[model samples]
Target: MAQAGEQAVGIDFGTSTSLLAVGSGVGPVDIAPLGRTTRSFPSIAGYQQGNLLVGEAAENLPIAQVIRSVKRAITDCSETMEISDEHGTRRVDVDEVIVALLAEIGTRAKAAGRPLDTREQVRLGCPAMWDGAQRQRLLDHAQNAGLPVAHSTLIDEPIAAGVAWVRHRYLQYGEQVEGRLLVFDMGGGTLDIAVLDVVGGPHPEISVLSALGVQLAGDRLDTAIAGEITEELAGQGIRLDGLPEAKTVEALVLREARTAKIQLTTQARHRIVFRGLARTQLPILTYTREQLEECFRPQMDQAIGLVWAALRAAKLTELGGHAPDKLRGMNGDRLAADIDYVLLAGGMSRVPYVERRIGELFPNAMIYDAAGVAADELIVAGLADPVGYDRLNLHRPGFDFVLEYTESGRKITEKIYPAYTPFYSPEEAWTNSYLGFERRGDDFPGPKRGEGVLRVRSTSGDYLALRYDGETKHGLRLQLGWNMLFKIYCDGQILITDGARQTRKLRVHQWPVVRGNGHAELVLQRVDDAPPVPSTAWYLEKEYAPPGL
Candidate 1:
């Protein structure tokens, strides 16, 4: 129960897990998962015989009626929300399901000694493509959970992953921003690909150029792999049979198979035994890493293609002007047109094939193995930025920031430079070039022809700097079907684009910002001033634009 006037904490309510951190002590500390000071909490909630079980309790239940993939339901509105209880079945609101899990964890934090009545501001992370509707639902849910959100904001997933990765890299290495940093987060619900240039200083700076994100992540890949495995076994005449439901066996077997696949990262192979599998004799099966890779090789290759596409989107010229800084860090891979450095992070990145494939894909790329920086992801990232819980009290309105967003989905869509995604150092927080827009619910300011789109982003990264990255999955040759989305600055009077034109006015829209899960929508904002800003000293470049903008 945080009291009024208290600074809010940082909560990473991930799809597969829930993590809580306070800006107190030295750096943000992850409240214990099951005990005091724990870092990771299993993302499972269950409704049982007249009781709600969460975390370990729900995880250990026989056959476990716990809800595991609740996040998926949030995005798929047509899907029903139901959970099996010991006595029978129960249907619940999707938001309430999440609230139950949140309350469970919040209670754990309180029990673990986190002082009550001390959180005021809240910073949340969402997918880059999360429509305005999904964001609104999230806000509403947070309120119902009793989490007061003053100075509330949404952080892109890749940017949040960028923050977790950059911080870990700096803490592992030295002080100055290290070489070109690219954080590839293939999480449960979405895949966020970001590249950044970390600047040098006592604190550090991160400049992000682009982040190509989509709803394809580890779980989705797991499902595909499981299907392939089933197909392979079926081809051998080992059919799942005699089960209560044939589909259930495949689904449960697939889930277990994926767990084993992840385990194979360290173990040569993993085997599971499902007493009720279709094939009685082969009810227990074993799988090797090579086997798993073989089943999902095509998808992995597609992932690599996306990575290369991201590099091409960056459009970094080898010219003397701005060679990719061999050592820099930030959100979105804006430092290089071609990835010479691949920084793999997140829980799923443990797959050896991920590292192996990255090396194979980019013959010239350097991959930094941060010892699978997943368990201590955020804590180890606590280094670079010295300001932890102490700065929570200030509540500074102006945090020096450069914003980037897709005006239209195209080659440039992947490279919108944001200030919050990558880990960075301390920097000033005023701006003359900075134009502002309010993202309340679905309301947003739209762009007009000749008026470039300007994305207003909150300053949330540990470091400060700007870099852009991009990728053309559909290819620019198919430009006829592409709607150009430029990431630029709005100095008020004229919109900005780093392209052939820098001055333009975006048309304001009265519609609404996006609120759906897989859709992206933006409403045009009204501009009162002809020329915007009182002028926060511009320390970085005057303008930032995505590749081929």
Candidate 2:
């Protein structure tokens, strides 16, 4: 049994399936099984007679009473969804549904001989495209679910998957796996692809080169197969009867279709006999592997195209562009020799046809099937960063903090925080933290206002140079309907710029500094004698505005 202290746990809060695992401190990092299968738990939840059901129990419940793919609703900014029961249909908060599912993961963890709620630290994975609000909602749900989280972090799902792949390569081959890797994740609700560069060593580093996602995935294929089955049953004079509404019948067919889809992974054909469905015995729908493959052919092709697009977006492979020193060895559409492996993750990646297609596409590289490692367990295993397994880097920030102002009839703008400032570098032991922006005017000065304070530190570089990033937009935008202030702190000195000075410089001799917002450059003059440094830490002190006294 593991000790009763800080137990590191990682949870992959996926759209179709969710999983939890414990790291080395609690013996080997292993996934906590959900009921019978050591694979994954359905990301489903139901509320019946005031009793919440999650995972397998939720799956066993009637389709009308349970909610599946709640992750999609959450991403759409939906507050609640309607579910029917004996009392009638009622609306339930989306957060509550997510909380119930997460709570189930905690319960199952405890039943597996380990308790997740008592863990020292927990890291949850989320989609890459999720914004601040979406990410916060996930954290709020986790907390409400009563997961004992002394410390918590939300990492990008693809990045976490990359961490797991690197670790697996090291353990299996006893060799450091370096070079670029492409992760094709086709889950129930979303298909996302990410290109990562894994630097092998005692401390492996994973950096995201590019990532792309589409709404079409396993669920979409399931719906397509269901439609085909429906057509086939109609041809046999077997129509769904005695169902309350068409939606219920459609849902029932989809459920059975998903089961058939899973079976097609190994079997050449599947017989989806709809007996007692809709209170009638629908004809047995026979779907051959070829038929199912034909149904999803277009979607499969799109998924393959997405992989190439992601690769091009990462600049690893390109077409019609003059060859540069960076991407030297390249034939059109062919990946670079440096790309060591192509890893297929997520539940849909297990499809035999999909695996075969990916292998044929990347003939030079070894293709890894996620089934061996368990798709849902990959990200959770990445939470073991403290034990030398982690994504050691971050992609460039999408936006740049710029100060723009009108100077002598001409507008001048200066970038304060340039894109890619080494947010969460490999040497750093902790993740990067973003400055908080509140709704109050006093807390963050209006856009017209200039000069604010900021604190910053770096794991590398002597002088933190502020440069222009042509890639990001250059403008100021309010956060949550409130204006923001720029802060740049170097050592104990604060430099406030509001685009007034074309050239600005801050010297701190490599010491950690602060951040601020302004349009003018500040050059502090050395004095023969100055007041002793304030006893209180500058960061702890709040900016004060004196009353008109």
Candidate 3:
């Protein structure tokens, strides 16, 4: 719920462009005009005349002075950008640039008659592959830019796009839509895919089955097209390699390639011209849809592969397995058949070739292109929607908890909690009994009168060492469980209900400034300064093993 005189705000802080929308908690969300005639503000900024400029104003600066795709740089762990201009080179913090751009967005929103209030609820969108660290970074930046938002207010970009699609269909048909939906969001920096199950009624319920993302999208395509143009120029003996402003020329070529790419979405061909380079004017070139398709095919194939991977992950979730190949009778065709609708979103989704390829892949599923509603507006609209905003059930982190130990002179990794497990739902809390520490041979006495370490690992390479100190004659039976509050506990017993047992829960002591593959980093401090002895005697009992053991 929003406060009085407050409008809900949704900010899609995208890689290439950022958009803002505001609603009065009653009517449809209105896309705020960032500029006089543009709804989107370029995700770029620069310093001109010793003052910071953002969006279109920054676009007017020299390519070397301007920083483009700041969102992508943030995701890639970039901390600073060097802007070289007539005033000389100066190092600028990436966070400062992001905050400046966001502040400008807020300024424009106010000018559009939708003044952003700190009491109003604000939702920000991030790529699906971004882990907790990245999400928190964005939240901090937003708050620094005077936006009222928290970590809980951050939503996955693809999930927000899905909500937008669901809302659009519900409004268009005047009926609630229910089915399995696959949202493909190919933005400038990343391609995010989400498979969701929607239950339509007076109160809609949306559940995300699986979600995945890759760092391949419109920017990569732009780079590919630019590379092709460079090669063509090289073949024509028009070499810019030894030129004084090679970097400037390269930047100009990339900008033109991006413009051509956007124009080719509507027209079959686009004419690109590179001007204002360091004393040399490159010839105008004609870029056709076919040529664009050629540049996009390989990346599209990779994106399609990621879609299949996401589908397989979803199927694994439905089938209650740790791996896709371990599930019986599972294939691509079955996965494709299970999808009821495919929602294309993001700026890259506007490409006709991308739409056609998706249609061909999922022939049976109904395809909803973003052309009907502008791609840039989808996330913000969904964020501001009161109905969908309240009912949306965003998917939790998709990461597997694994236990690694040495058994019989070989290293073994056992998945304790499979990916997509509903750890946040009390009714869906899962328990695994596959963890055990026993006396294997004379070499291993099962932590007899000494402490041993049980290494707990995550799919994202985060790990924790659980120390077990006790004297067990027979063995130690370990049970791992995840509660509704996103907490994981490991209870170790001496094979007797009333016997000596140690229960340890790994909780985040402090938020670590580390990044991972969409997985929360498990940070825990050692109880003692002593070195932990690796528990090589631990093994998983076959009787209690889950599928894909």
Taken over the whole model, the C-alpha lDDT of each candidate is 0.47, 0.59, 0.66
The candidate that achieves the highest TM-score relative to the unseen native structure: 3
lDDT of 2: 0.59
Range of the 10 consecutive residues with the lowest summed lDDT in candidate 2:
429-438
lDDT of 2 by residue, 1-549 (tens): 123233567888788788777665323467777655745778888876788778777766767677888987766789988887667778888887898888888788778876765434577877665554566677778888887542125666776677777766665565688788888877877777888878864457666666667777888999899888887877777565534554566677988889888999889988886543454445566788898789989998988777665664466212112223323334424653545688877888768888887777777788876522666456667654334333244443322444444445665544455432322221221221221111133443334444322312121111223322322222223222133334332121222323232112222122111122321122232211233333333342243210000
Clashes of each: 72, 28, 0
Per-model TM-score, in order, reads 0.62, 0.70, 0.74
The C-alpha RMSD in Å for every predicted model, in order, reads 13.0, 12.4, 10.8
lDDT pick, better of 1 and 3: 3
Model 3 Cα lDDT, one tens digit per residue, 400-506: 44444455666566554443333322111222332222222232223223223334443345553333342222222433222111122211111211112333322
Order of the predicted models by TM-score, top scorer first: 3, 2, 1
Q: Which ten residues in a row have the lowest lDDT in candidate 1?
A: 423-432
- How many angstroms is residue 498 displaced in model 1 relative to the true structure, after the best TM-score fit? 22
Once fitted onto the true fold, the runs of candidate 2 whose alpha carbons sit more than 4 angstroms away are 1-7, 25-28, 36-39, 88-90, 117-119, 148-152, 237-245, 276-278, 316-332, 335-338, 370-372, 388-391, 398-446, 452-498, 501-549
Of 1 and 2, which scores higher on lDDT?
2
Q: Write model 1 residue lDDT over 1-549, tens digit each, in one string.
A: 222233335566667776665533233334444333346677777766667676767765544256776776655643456655555556756666777776766677677665334333445566554544565666667657766542234445555554554544444454454555566766677766665555533234454444555567677767876776677568778676644545446556667766876788898877766654343444457777778778657767767655653443233222111222321222334424345456675566777877787666555666665522453254223321223212111101122222233455732222233322221111111111222222211122233222332333323222222111222111111111113323222121113333332323333221111212322222233232234433322421233321222
